[model samples]
Target: MADLVTEIRERALALGFDAFGIAPAEARPDLGDKLAAALAAGWHGDMDWMAETAERRASPKALWPEARSIIMLGINYGPDSDPMAMLARKSTGNISVYARNRDYHDIIKGRLKEVAGLLSRRTGAEVKVFVDTAPVMEKPLAQAAGLGWQGKHTVLVSRQFGSWLFLGAIFTLAELPVSEPMAESCGSCRRCLDICPTNAFPAPFQLDARRCLAYLNIEHKGPIPAEFRKAMGNRIYGCDDCLAVCPWNKFASETREAKLFAREDLREPPLSELLALDDAGFRALFAGSPIKRIGHGRFLRNALIAAGNSGDAALLPAVEARLGDGDPLVRGAAVWALAQLADGERVRRGAEAHAGGERDADVKAEWAAVLPEVV
Candidate 1:
């Protein structure tokens, strides 16, 4: 059994996986408590799926009672440059490093499937595979399989790979020997906590997703809660401020997968160009990328927030044009952006023109809300 496992690890490395391990598939009693606490606090924000799939994610045995061993795999997507650098260029959008290229779900799923097939053929073990899409508790399972520790940021932190790994898991009926779990090695560092633009971390190893920029920009729909908009800065997609600051990243290596590297067009894309995108243009730009999932309305909503913060005055035309956008979400965001860049008289004129036809309560409130702050 040990020899076969060794052979599997070698094959995984050959197939582009940087880390691999196995552990017993049993009920994780502690996960239930942590998940319950997070949900009770409403830290998951609009990601209600976390609550809907709680039971299955809480227990591996509940998910697959037939499985005796769980295999965790890691593939590095470490950035070639500091992702934070883009923040300095405020006229451009700062997207998370992970979304700068092809969607990882598409890339890692194929690799995981290939490795799972090899192991099944070798040992005749019945197997199932999963990527990020499932209800599986991958971070905890990966830690149990000896890949790495769950850091204070609530992401897996490896001594060799840092916080830059994308995890996948395989479940098999074979009772493979388990590896020793990796111990938490985050001494007393609070860099990940201190550097947050929104202070999303409530405590070490705990996150308030409601206050997280990534959550507001990605999973969140409709106009962003006004309080978080200023703090959001120029981030148009997911934020990577916390991940890029980790000390463990010193030991990390650049990804060997060309598909995972940053695409030149996506890396700090011009906010002006992004504002010009209609639904068809948005789809064309992000066709093969993960950013497409949020769709154009949400994408424009985020871009409008960045436009508000830009203070460029040049973006006023774009913001004004979006006031009549078919999507209410886009119009609300545009009202806020116009208020930020347009003079008081221009803002009032915009309210007169755009506010009359607007039926959405949220859009009407944005126009009214600006008067107290700017008028």
Candidate 2:
């Protein structure tokens, strides 16, 4: 069993996993209380699902008692380019490094299954692979398996891979030797907290997801709060402020996975181009990428916010066309974009044109407010 574990780790490394480990399928007994405390403090925000599945998340054995071992893997997806460089180009929407190309879930899942298959062949173990999709607490398990410790940012940070690695897990029936847990190395750093534009972190190792740009742009289903729009800047897809500001990233190497590298077109997409995308256009452009999952309406909604923060009147016409869009969320965001441009007369005229036609109450209220000067 020890030789098999060694062979599995070698194969996983050869298959491009930057870090790998195995752990017994037992719950971290104290994690449940910690998670309960986090929930009580409202650190999870509107990610109600996290709180809802607290029990299963706190324990791997509770999730699947039959699984005697967990094989944790981390794949580096670091970009050769600076993720922060796009901020200088205000008109171009700044997507986070992870989402700039192929979705990591698809890329890593395929590789995980391949490795799991090898383990099955060698040990005749029944296996199930997961990458960011299951209720299983991957970070805690990875930490226990010696991959890395959960940083103050709440993401696993490795000495070797930094925080640029994507996590995945394979649950198996075979009882494998458990790797020792990694010790927390972020002694007193607060770089991630200070770097947050919206101050999403309430404290170290805790996040208020509602205030997070990544949650607002991706997980959020309705109109983005007016408060977060400007702070969002040109980040149309997700925010990387916390991750980018980490000092440990200096040790990170660029990813060799061509598919995970940033796509030329997605690197710094013009807000105008993104705002111009209709549903079919969005699908065509974001094919095989996670951005496509948000659909055109939500995506354009985010693009409009970026355009608003862009302060470039050049995108006004594109924003104007959406004033009467079928989606109320898009219409509301368009009105906000126009307000940021502060071309009141143009916005008033656009509002008048859609007066009787507009039916959504939220959008109508936004149009009504546009007529009143901000005193």
Candidate 3:
């Protein structure tokens, strides 16, 4: 069993996984209660799937009855440059480091299957694989497997890889030797909590997804709640404040996988280019990226919010063009953007022409709320 575990670890490393560890399927007995408490507090925001998968998500055994041991793997995707610095370039969009390249789920899952296949062939054990798509509580499981510990901001922080690791898992019927769990090492540190633009972290190690830019800009379906627009700044796709601010990242290095490196266009795409994207253009641009999951309307909605915050008069025309967008969500964001960038006459004219024809209550509300101020 020890020899087999050693062979599997070497195989995983050869295949490009940066971190590997094993844990018993029942290693995290505390997850269910923790999940219940967070769900009860409504911290998950519009991601109702967290509640839907709670039972299966909280338990590896529940997810697969035959699973006796679990293997956790991680790929380091540390950025070559400071992600926070992108926020200053308000005319550009700040995509999170993880999404700057190809979708990690697609990259990690196939490699995980290869490692799982090796284990199954050696031991004749049934196996299952999961990435972020499944309800697999991967961070806690990764901590349990000694790859890292959950940091103050609730993201897994590796001593070697820092907060830049992308985690995946392989579950097996074979009872492989479990690795010792990592101890929390973030004593007297609150950089991640302090750096959050929207105060998403209510306390150390706890997050309210409702206020999280990552959740708001990505998972959220409706218009961004008004209060967070300015704070959202130029972060069009996802927020990296918490992860990038971690001190542990000082020890981290950039990703070894060429496919995981930030694409030249995605690193700091001009907000002007992103704002001009139609559905087909958005599809072609983000074809292999996780950003495409949000679709063009929401992507434009986020860009419009960034434009409103940009204070750049140059984006006024792009913002105004979105006023006639087919999607009310996009049109409403454009209204808010116009209020921020355009003068009173331009905004008033927009309201006079479009507010009357606008059928969406939310768009009407946007006009009503801003028209009083502009006038």
CA lDDT scores, all candidates in order: 0.89, 0.85, 0.92
RMSD of each: 1.8, 2.0, 1.4
lDDT of 1 by residue, 1-375 (tens): 788889889988888899998978983568888998899999998899999998877878878878899999998888888888888888889899889888988878898888889889988989999998988999999999999999999989999889999999999988899999999999999889999998899999999999999999999987899999998889999989889999998777643454367899998888899999989999999998999999999999999999999888988898899999999999999999998899989998888787876788888788779764332
Ranking by TM-score: 3, 1, 2
Off by over 4 Å in 1: 254-259, 372-375
* Candidates ranked, most accurate by lDDT first: 3, 1, 2
lDDT of 2: 0.85
- RMSD versus native structure for model 2: 2.0
In model 3, state the lDDT of residue 211. 93
Clashes of 3: 0
Tens digits of lDDT, candidate 3, 61-164: 88897889999999999898899999999999999999988999999989999999999999999999999888899999999999999998899999887899
lDDT of 1 at 184: 94
Model 3: lowest-lDDT 10 consecutive positions: 251-260
Top-scoring candidate (lDDT): 3
TM-score of each: 0.96, 0.95, 0.98
lDDT of candidate 2 over 216-273, digit per residue (tens): 9998988888788889899989888888877777677633455367888998889989
**Model 2: which ten-residue window has the lowest total lDDT?**
252-261
